[model samples]
Every structure is written in structure tokens, then in C-alpha cells.
Target: MHGKFKGKHAIVTGGARSIGFEIARQFCAAGAMVSIFDYNQEALEIATTTLTNEGYRVNPFLVDVSDQLQVNLAVDRAEEIAPVDVLVNNAGICLVTPFLNIEAEEWQKTLDTNLSGAFYVAQRVCRYMARRGKGVVLNMSSKNGLDGEFGHAHYNSSKAGLILLTKTIALELAHLGIRANAVCPGYIRTAMNTEVDSDEFVEEFEDRYIPGGRVGKVTDIAPIFLFLASDDAEYINGQTFVLDGGQLAGQKPWKWLLEEIKL
Candidate 1:
């Protein structure tokens, strides 16, 4: 509600739904001109309409993040309206398959969307930021990147690479006054995770994984991104903000105690 990002321009990749949509909404609410860039035309239109109707500055563009040409053109179009002040590399894909069963194309697809896509958008946006000598880039990584997830080797690898990419870019671009960082979210309630809607997964996710006793909502994450995008985090760079309710702290179990006893 505070005009933290007032008079700024931001682009949110994968802004159609879930985490990306929430980031876009927060940017708009905080007095930023938000651009929704996604591949889903229907969701793009719907999101644009809703946000614009709410008296927020919103513009939707249908583009595949993995395509460099599309990304460059979209940034160009967005710049025509206003120079982009923040870039959220939120577009990503997930494929759950056993490591042995994973196909080359499937791995490539996930990598292209999750890791390479961030590179493409970042490279493009950095051009604009370089000219202005100021901007922020926020990459979306996941807890799976830190701790491997079964049936998600490709996704894990892609996100892991993305985090390193974030760090490298941060170090390299600091001289240009561009800040880069990542957000790793664990067990967020999103459309992609239909299991969150099921009673089965909800019970499992809460009882075993998240110590917070509940899954994260989109609203839970938007503020963090907004903070990173704003000048408030000017000193925070090349770091990852983990919002997993201490999931990475490791799970408590009895078997480990027996091993410790033997030791």
C-alpha cells in the first residue's frame, strides 16, 4: 500500500498466474507501472483486465520467455512506455520424472525455460538498466535447487544453475548499479502444484515438511520480491532470501538419532 515503488516501471515474467501474478500485483499496488509478460494469452488478458480495472497500471504481453527474440522485442516495447526499473525473472517450467526416465528434450525444455530463460531476459533487461545505470533483477529459484527432490532432477538442476547465475550477474553488474538476487520458495500453494488442493498432499506437506504448519500462499512471497525490487534492499545483493518456514533446516527424525547413538 505504501508507494515504495512509485514512478518506477517493472516487468514480471510468467505473470499470468501463481507467484509471478502475485509479484506483478504487488508492484502495481506499490505504485509501479507493472508489465505482465507470459506465454498464456488467456491468463494474460484476464490478469491485465483485473489489475487495470483496479486502477493499477498494467499491460500484458504474450511472449515465451525462452525465446530471446521475443524477450528483446517485449522489453523494447515496454521501454517505449517507460524505462524498466525492475526485472523479475519469474518464468519457469517443471517436469517430474525419474532421472532414469527423463528424456533429453524434456531436460532441455526445463533448462531452456527455467535457467536459460532467465539469462535471456536478464541480458535484455540489463541493456536497458545499463543505459540508466540503475535497476534490480530478481530471479525465482526453489528449495528443490538446494535440496534435491525425487522425480525432479531436471527441475532441480535448472533452478540450481539459476541461483549461481544470479550470483554471477550480481557480482558482474554491481558496477553498473544493478542489483541481482534470488528467492527460494518451498511448498507454495500455486496452480502448478495441484497437489496443494488435494487433502492428501496438504496433509503430507504440512505434517512432514513445513514447520510453519501450513503451505505458503502467493501473498506470502509478493512482499519479499517487492522489497528486493525497491531501493530498500540496496545493500542486499548476490544473496538468496529463503521463504520456506525453515524447511531447509532439515527434518527431525528418529533414525538419525540411532546413527548418532552408534557414533
Candidate 2:
């Protein structure tokens, strides 16, 4: 609660749960007024009510980030509540399917939600941030964004586009006093990972992958968002912070390599 983000107001897309929710939690803990936006009305209500009861100033907005009209309306509505000082484009979707078997509609949906959604939200939010002459933007990406995955062609491509979009947005908005950066995480343990967190999958994944001997937690990645959104990161922009616990340090798990090298 002692960071440079104190007293700022933020809009966190897809903040109903998972990494988005954790980001909102830390921001509020750091003394920022947070508005959580998500299309999931149930989770939105639950999150907002829970935070409100805890004495944090939180408002929930129900809107689909992928739709331009919805994005604009949500931003306008949020602006009415308070000027947006920071924006976290955390709303995105991921699906695993072979590249050859993926359908055109599914591919379009992946890009629309994962890549274009960030664009739509940023386009609207930055207008106000630009006028104010000082604001921050954080985009949620994945390690697959850097390295292509076998069954996640659509998701991987969208995230790759998002990373570049983040870089370009940073440059375009820098002159206006706005900062943009992307966070690329790997195998975070959130509700989104339930499908992969099963016993068999865990045995398969953590057995050979995740050199740290564990999957990542939402809390582990939350601070990066909090940092990028704060004045402490004023000089940091257009960069992607990877939070995979040495999963991408090299071709081999660096942790295991270190153990062997030490022995």
C-alpha cells in the first residue's frame, strides 16, 4: 500500500477473477480506486461486492471487451465515475487446438478477443489518458507469445500480436505521457488453468516442465502489473516482463541445470 500508485484510479478489464482479480486486489491494497470490468455478470457482482465490503472503493462494469461498442460504453461509464489514471488490458481468451484443425471462426474469435480487444480498450482509454497527459497501460500476454506452442496456434498468434501492439502503443502514447508495457506469464495457476491442473496433466506438465518444480500463482504475477501501473515504473515502457519461474531461461530448465552444475 506504499507504492507510487496511491490515490490513482484504475480500470482493470476481466477483473472478475484470476490474474485480473489479483491485480485489482493489490492495486486497491496500494490505495488506488479500482473499477473491475468483465462480461461475466455473476463473478463481477461477487468480486465488487466482496471488495466493497472490505472497505475498498470498487465498482463493477459489465461489458464485453472484444466489442468496440461495449468497450467505448464501458470506458465512458467508468470515466463518469472517475478519470481513469491507469488501464490494465487483462481481458483475453485462450483455446488449444491443432493449427490445421482450427476453424476460421474460432481463429477470428481468438484474435478478436485476445488481440483486438486490447486495441479497442486502449484506443478508448488512451484518449482520456492522453488528455490528462499522464497514465499507464498494462497488457497481459503469455510466453507462448514469444515461442509458438503445439496446440495453441490461435492463442499464440493473438498473444504475439498483442506484444507488438503493446510496443507500438507505447511509442505512440509516450509523447503524450502515457506508458505501455506487456507481461508475459507461463502456466499460471488460476481458474483458467483448471483444465490443465488435473492430476494427470499436472504429473505430465510439472514433471518435465516448470524448472522451479511448480506452476506459477496469480499473486506471483500480480506485482508486475502493480509496478507497471505505478510511478515507480515511470521510466519503464514498451517492455515485456516474463514471469515464468525460469521456464524460459534456456532450452533446459535452469534450476535443474544449476543443481547439476553445482554437483
Candidate 3:
């Protein structure tokens, strides 16, 4: 427990699996007491067991971040274990439906979870951090926040709001020694992404969209979160880091470029 983050405590929402899980693991590895807030009870149990077996301090709480009451209660429970020094608002959901086909409920659900949930957690945690005069908040934004995509209007809007929310938090919390930033990832190969896309589609996507020629893995993103949470990132605030493998650097004129090139 004598590492870079020794004596620190972190809460990672959606920390049961995928990117969130990796973030929690990295924090625990760095000697931080980590609490995982996830809606999936089974996944939470599994994650807790796995981390505990690995000799890491991990506490799992069943929390639906979209509900302020639940978030508040969860925070109370986590504080009993350790005062939160870092908060990663990584819980989010995406819907793939044509704009015309998107229902009001679906749109609300996306915003409720992605934007409002982040707000609730950050606001609650910053209150405590403000008292202590130090903390870090890392939000999981997306490449869609910078650029729109087809069939993802709701998802895009939520992430876009989150980026602004991160900036707002940074502005308001800086005086209290709190830093807020967003990480925008594109096409990360997570369970959620793989559920939506086939392997063939992913291969094609890497070839056409990702200049780096590979979809990003959870490992590729976890270290960045750790860096943002550490003291080394004291000056980095209100910034959005796009970990998209150059996918957003330029437009992909797939049809035109393919027609021009034999390969």
C-alpha cells in the first residue's frame, strides 16, 4: 500500500467490467482503496472477488448512478470505508437507433445515465473534496462528443453534455484543489462494443476508420485514468483527451478512397 496513490481512495462507477474494471484495477494496483459502483450485482460480486483474491482492497456497491438518492446513499456507504480522493464517472449507456425512430424514453434514459448521473456523483464527491481542498474527477466522454455519428443522436448529445460538464466542474472546483477532465475514446474493444458490433465489422472498421489499424483495448485506456488521478496531473484540468487512434483526426471518405486505391 506504499505506492504512488498510497492512502488515496477512489470510486469508479461501472467498475464491474471492461474499461471501468481496468481503471479500478489500476487504481488498486497503485495502492488506492477502490470502491466499484455498478448496477450489475453479479458482475460486482465477481469483480470484488477477483480483486480481493489478487490482494487488492476493493469494495463493490450496487448503485444506479442515474438516481440521486441511490448515488447519495452509495457515497455514504463508501465514505464509511474510506473518504473518496478520486472519482471516475465512467458509467454510461449508448443506444443505436435512427433519429426518427428514437423514442422519448430512450433519449431520456441516455441523458439520465450519461449526463445526469455524472453530475450527481461529481457534485456529491466535490462537496467532500472541497472540504479537504483536494480531489480528482475523471469523466468518460466519447469521440462522438466531438463529432456526430449516424444512429447515435441521443448518445452523442449525452457525451457532448458530459464534456461541457467536465469543463464546468473544473472551472468551479479548481479553487478547492479539485481537477476535472474527460477521456474521449473511440471504438474501444469492450464487451459493450463487441455486443453491438461483429468481429467482421470491427476488422473493417479498423481498416477504414482507425489509422492506427487496431481497435483500442481497455488496457490502453486505464493508465491514462490513473495518470489523471495522480498528483502528476495537478496542472491538467478541464481538458478532453481523445484516445481514438487518430480516428477523429480526419474524415474517412471510405467509398471515394476505396475506389481510387486498388488495395
Best by lDDT: 3
Model 2, 129-243: lDDT tens digits are 9998988999999999998889899999999998999999899989999999999998887888786558678656765777777888899999988878776788999999999
Q: Tens-digit lDDT track for model 1 on 27-114?
A: 8988999988899999999899989899999989899999989988998999999999999999988778999999999999999999
Q: After superposition, how far is residue 139 of candidate 1 from its true place, in Å?
A: 0.2
Clashing pairs in 3: none
Please report, as a residue range, the 10-residue window in candidate 3 with the lowest summed lDDT.
Answer: 250-259
Superposition error at 54 for model 3 (Å): 0.2
Taking all chains together, each candidate's TM-score versus the true structure is 0.94, 0.95, 0.95
Model 2 ranges with Cα > 4 A deviation = 253-263
Worst 10 residues of 1 by lDDT: 254-263
Relative to the true structure, how large is the alpha-carbon lDDT of every model?
0.90, 0.88, 0.93
Tens digit per residue, CA lDDT, model 3, 1-263: 23899888999999999999999998999899999999999999999999999999998899999999999999988888888999999999988999999999999999999999999999998988999999999999999999989999999999999999999999998999999999999989988887889999999999889878899999989999989888888899999999999999886666666589866
Candidate 1 residues lying further than 4 Å off, grouped into runs, are: 195-197, 253-263
The local distance difference test score of model 1 is 0.90
TM-score of candidate 3 on Cα atoms, chains taken together: 0.95
lDDT of 2 at 156: 93
